[model samples]
Target chain A: MSSPKAKVLLVGMGGVGSVAAYSLEYGGKAEVTAVLRSDYQTLIDDGFEFESVDHGKVNCFRPTNITKSVEEAMEKYGPFDYAIFSLKNIPDISPIEPLIAKCYTPEVGILLLQNGIGIEKPIFKLFPEAYVMSGVTMVSSTLYGRKVVHVATEHVRVGAYDNGKIPYEKQVAKCKKFIEIYSTDKNDIIYDENVNFSRWRKLVYNACVNSSAALTDCDIGRLEVFGAMDPIVRPAMREILAIAKSDGVDLPEDVIEFMIRSDDGEWYPPSMLVDMRKGNYCEYQVILGNALDIAKENGVPAPVLSCMYHLLHVVQMKTQEKKGKFVLPEVRPLPADNFQIKYLN
Target chain B: MSSPKAKVLLVGMGGVGSVAAYSLEYGGKAEVTAVLRSDYQTLIDDGFEFESVDHGKVNCFRPTNITKSVEEAMEKYGPFDYAIFSLKNIPDISPIEPLIAKCYTPEVGILLLQNGIGIEKPIFKLFPEAYVMSGVTMVSSTLYGRKVVHVATEHVRVGAYDNGKIPYEKQVAKCKKFIEIYSTDKNDIIYDENVNFSRWRKLVYNACVNSSAALTDCDIGRLEVFGAMDPIVRPAMREILAIAKSDGVDLPEDVIEFMIRSDDGEWYPPSMLVDMRKGNYCEYQVILGNALDIAKENGVPAPVLSCMYHLLHVVQMKTQEKKGKFVLPEVRPLPADNFQIKYLN
Candidate 1:
């Protein structure tokens, strides 16, 4: 007898989350429910729109199940088999905890579909008894307003979160089941045993492209202009590779080469650049800053990574300043310490 | 014959150029001529205005000599004793060559009151027989419209272009003479024998504060927040120190320490940030890129400096794109070689 169909609740419907939802529903495999915080009304009222090369057009995609918050999702769908998180990791923000809390169940497995290093740590720490799987998606997507998403390419790698207490068989079983339900003609989901390796690999591309694109305001193609790949891109990747090696995560030998050559002249702006253009806070903290922290802990001198992290922070702060959230400190005059007023007053 | 008072022609009447002109005129020394490129008409018609803490407000005080271009200035003033260049260093622009070409004379010395390394090379190369000197100023000033410059604090270090062929006596003589005429109560000019040392010293501040301010769009005070000093600023400085050491130029050990601690909560925006805000190209090439090149040539690892240089390049490319001069390469489609020759025939 076949096992029951997996029930999935996806959070944060930016680009990746929405793509996952559409792929699952289009494939007609899983009972996919999505929790959208910001544009719940828009999706409910207008439905989700997706323009895909693989699957012609999806207009007003009212998902099988959708709600505003995780609490609402839990109320409507009961307990989910897997809770997939695809939210951005903005620094100084704490919305993730409540979402995880509302979705917690002893049997429900967790899957983190976010971009960053060691994102699963907090989740694993919070739910030590829970089965937590980690994922890295190499899906090129763009969001137009509240409902529209343009999926350029889609591929996903899933594995167990590193340093978790879960056994390998359980982790692989969960990942394999999720992939079986998640894969569509448009999206390819892989069950990888080495989740840490996958995270580190995706990180190389993220650290180099996302920060450079946002900073340069150039897409992948324009970034390679005037031999930037030779001087700036490769050197930065080399530095990140060293940091990754120091952390005992040996990525492929030609990872940097693969990352650079994989551009294929596509002028797709990375998500961070899109965030920067829209004056929104980017996911730099998790993407680059977290890796920088690890490098520091490992005593690896990752100067280029450190520079990229801070430069991205500068871009983030500039956006924050524009939003009126970051105000410059006021200048004050010094005191007249040695002045005598006498009778002149 | 007391060397017939130095006839000086100042180029690029931005803040620095205007400040030098005012200080010279206020000191009642030299026949100070200025080349006002953008605001020649306004300066000639309404005269120069200065609002200064050191030299109180001076309204509509016309100079003895002012012209639109180097040709006009040379035509009006006949081969001045010194041609002071207080212009910015923008890559892929050629304003300097024309200025030098029009104002060429053997007797006249060249005082490059500009920030950046190896800037004196082209000038020295052009006029092999001319006496060339380099000057780095610590003058706090800003330009208001076409005429006014508010001089806040002023100190100048004048030295010979280190790698030039001019004799030491000649270099010192020119610097001393220029300082004698250029000093006001608002400005102090000093003659330093080691110009390379001074350049490297000033570079510490430039590579750190200037690049940070421009990249983050934050003034000095705000940059200190969020521990940027520990992560970004100091690491960049350390890389620059390595570059400087490879070039055999020993900057003071306390230069970085001195620079960071000296920012006593003043919200001063560096020049590069001002230019960046105005959508103008900055001096990253001379300030950071040149150092990176030197580091590469010397085989000294300067990852932080390299990242800073490229990130600054990205910002510059954004500005260029805004100016309508930079268009991204078009995305080409794949070949249609396998199509049928006859369609519906």
Candidate 2:
């Protein structure tokens, strides 16, 4: 079924990355060079263990090459057809340009299977001529160290990201080529004509559920049990809709009901909450920050979205403080001895 | 200073309660019957130790009498001229009616030196004919167990709480009588003709700074350090102002700037934040919940305030869960073994 093996480098091989590498490689469509920053050596020794409903229990599914850095991946597997990013989108900690520039080639296109709106803009600004493919995934995969548990249903919406300068047909051709390699018979892959619409749609769920759980220190299931999803999460979803409307995307109002009901019973913690649990920085920038900037730009009165952005900013900043990346000033309690009433002018 | 000493029953001997008890008694115009709940025995053995700038260190400033329960205080010191409330206004866990009903007398006019708008309503509703006096204070006091530290400058504005049924002049006379007994030569106290004005002004600070700190798990100092005061806190203050306007009150626009500037350099954690650190339920109901209700009632779009309310609700609920009041459902990880793609209708 393969015309020729397309060489793709996947950066940040965590939950989604491992599953994607598994899906692409298992389909015999592409050979992936994985960039495992923390678990490179462990992955090289044990490889990825998958317990999937689709592929069944598979042991030690190794990539074509496992490199610890993007530069390392490029040196070994240079001039690749494409490089996919399944990493977190935290621009304050790590920017996208320097990393993407190392993997850049005129012929090679870029694929981002990351979350959040306006993520493509940075890369698009960096490499104006480079074809960028965006992927919106609904895959339930968890990579706990070297082991992956793919919990059944997987569907992805892939589309070409418009830079406005590039021809539409040329962009579609490159995007289609990515789908060809990434898609499996079992995978429900849809080619989205308008990727931004799909992104804003995904945000309706992520912005609502993820922010509610993390900010409240409650999981999604508990949030539902507390009868808070409507009062807290629904209003946030509505704000996102208002912001998206300003972007000329009319996300169907029923999508809010659909998302809330879909997550009604499931007790799974989303990515941002898990990020906080691990003491790792959350992807608040991608999830809430970028959309909020648009809301500000278009004069959309997005109160809930703005609050999430600011609150999540502090949350991320705190994680930064924990990591020694940011130093928080000590808030001294009112000094008991210095209670002098020096009247001011 | 030859006036007969007024009899007062002070409930909830926390930070503010102890200070108010001290101020009213130290003035030599009021004799307070203090309700020391948990620390009743500790305080009985070794009475309050005060380190104050205004009054100096007044050792063993025991009230006229100290009782553990409100019922005990009622029995020990009945027919009190006034019963002052300085505890948190969390209506969810503890409502106003039951507690105040025990302390109520035909002559005992209720005085609330607590934070929040619309708090006087419940007590007024219960004791419709009972004259309710409201007090707004800018006194920074901290009581760590038996130790009381008065951190200098204290200013209070006292006024009559109108229940619509009560005549304005009758209410003012009751309010003035209470203030006359509570005020000292050292204290900066004012008689407020309109108490709601002062309450809303205080809300300008409380609603913004308090919620921002608690929800973000950050102190006010850190929020300022992160350059978040202008972006996060200011917007929330503006929202409060708009909500205030709907109540037929016009808080000056500079009040936003003034509130932000006042909290600019201070690193002290606000009450809500302190409540969170102690794992005690925050006073979010009084600070954010009631204001959010007002915002909703008037159709004022308060994104930031609403976000804080919902988020704090979750935070409080999580604490409730920690205390075994709420049972958080298990958010099970996606089961890899049984990942069936059962197509739905």
Candidate 3:
């Protein structure tokens, strides 16, 4: 018998989600369905365009199962074998709780292609019977007008949440099939023993490099070349590592080096920096909020990251106030007196 | 005899020197001898123009004692009672060493209005017989064409070198008279017990505030509002404090607060930022070089400051190559281990 075609549903078709959907469809290993906030009529009338750095423009007219609401998505693409959750970390998880309850099944798996550490536990609590897998994408993508532009092509790694203890064989299989669809290289998928370390590794990269790049308003490539990177980047990374260690996550020194050196000496602009450039809200909460929360719980010192988060939160708050929408990410308060400021007066 | 007229020679007819010269003349404190390099012939021919942010423009001609060389300056304005050294920290000390040796008499007190710390020590070594004093000017002056514009009415603090062992009472009196001639308020000159602390304070400010601002290419006023300031600025301040402590300079905690909480609470752009904006070679050595040296001597880790210095040095080196001047600032090498890239994979 022929291998079964995996059914994948992508919620929130932003830059990342759009790219993942296109990748899944282009690779032809899965039947991809994209659920977007915009009306299906608009996207149907004007087909989606995909542009990538590695691959040229590929436009085709296929039945792009698009819907505005999750309910409509569930009705149209119900019992999805795998759901790719790549939404912004805003509006909380309350709105999605009911949807997850309705669509979640014992056999179906959920893969989170979002930033931040420990987003799976809350969802797991909401749907204890369903399997949840965590993953991080190094691919850099952005939405330029209606077209999705992939700036950087990196690999994707997904693993069973919490070390795959609760019968995640089907979920693992689904994730592997989805990875094959999304990635040009099949070896990119790494089913980790504990996905928390992988999540923390990516989080550390974003917390230090992304936050600094956003704050400085410089491209990542130029920022690394500039002198400000070390003083700004290292302390923030160290703080994130401290918080992770306290939370029982052991991040290897080599992992930190890999994250820093992974840029291939080329300046890759992080999502936060790109958002800041566009005058939009960033996922500061995903990167910094998690670290700050862990720092508070573990009682680790994180003065530099705390200050950065505070300033970024203030900026995000101002941006949200102007936008009149809760599209911006949330930031957690940092522990008090984690670090002291010394003056020469 | 008319208090010997207090003959004063000012080297470098830059914006700051021109303003100081004007202040000294208007204050009737001394006989102001303004010396300029070959490029400032226009200012000598066409009278000096002074403009204030609060007040309007005022024009005056003092027939500046312009000279092509320092030897000529000494010949024309010899046996000077005070010499204001306010040149860019380039061309090394070799150019000025002989001139100071020849012209620096026991009565001639050298006032260093340059950025950074430990500059006076080199001068002290070069001219042991002459007295050296260090001072910091909070005044903001810039040159627009032939006009010297004062953006803020900030005060200056002057102190004798080595805890006032050199009988600076006469020199202070001379400075007071010069301030009056330059139309500066009498309250601007501050004499303290230890001027070295003030120098250290300024160094800390430069290392943290200036270097970051330059690297980010943001104005001080804008940097305060920029989200990156906290991450980029605070650690730089901490690293500088660490280096200072290692160098045996005790900076009070309050000074750091004061630096952050300026009277205006707006970002205060350092001269380094201005230099970066203008695409001029910065005085990186005078600012970060000294701190790096002290940090090395004290065996303290100063990765941030060292990185900033190195980046600035590279920029300077590149500029020098383009200009074919070979005028790069001297910086102390950083600790090998501390200088290694931790995050850059």
Best by TM-score: 2
Models ranked on TM-score = 2, 1, 3
Q: What does candidate 1 score in Cα RMSD to the true structure?
A: 6.8
For model 3, how does the per-residue alpha-carbon lDDT over A269-300 read when each residue is reduced to its tens digit?
77788888787778887678767877988789
User: Per-prediction DockQ scores?
Assistant: 0.31, 0.35, 0.10
Write out the backbone clash pairs for model 1. none
lDDT per residue, candidate 1, B23-92, as tens digits?
7777877778888777888888887777866677878765678888888889888788888988876745
| Per-residue error (Å), model 1, residue A305 | 1.2
TM-score of candidate 2 to 2 decimals: 0.89
Please report, in order, the local distance difference test score of every candidate based on alpha carbons: 0.75, 0.82, 0.66
TM-score of chain B of 3: 0.82
Candidate 1, residue A233: lDDT: 73
What ranking emerges by lDDT with the best candidate at the front? 2, 1, 3
lDDT of 2 by residue, A1-345 (tens): 538899988987877788888888878889899898888888988888888767788888888888988898899887689889888887878877788999998778788888999889888777888888898988888888778888856788989987777888998998898888888977877889998999999999898889888887777766766557777789889989999999999999999988876654577687788888889888888888899889889998777777777888888877777777744335432323333222222
The positional error of residue B236 in candidate 1, measured at the CA in angstroms, is: 2.8
Instruction: Supply the global lDDT for candidate 1.
Output: 0.75
The per-prediction i-RMS, to one decimal, reads 8.5, 7.4, 11.6
Put down candidate 2 lDDT per residue, B1-345, tens digits, no spaces. Answer: 587788899998877788888888888889899987788997789998988766788888788889988898888777689998888878876776787899898668788888898888877667777888898988888888788888865688988888677687887888888888888877887899878989999999899999988887787766765556777788889989999999888999998867766754477677888888889888788888888889889999887787788788878877877777645335432323333222222
State how far residue A291 of model 3 sits from its true place (Å). Answer: 3.4
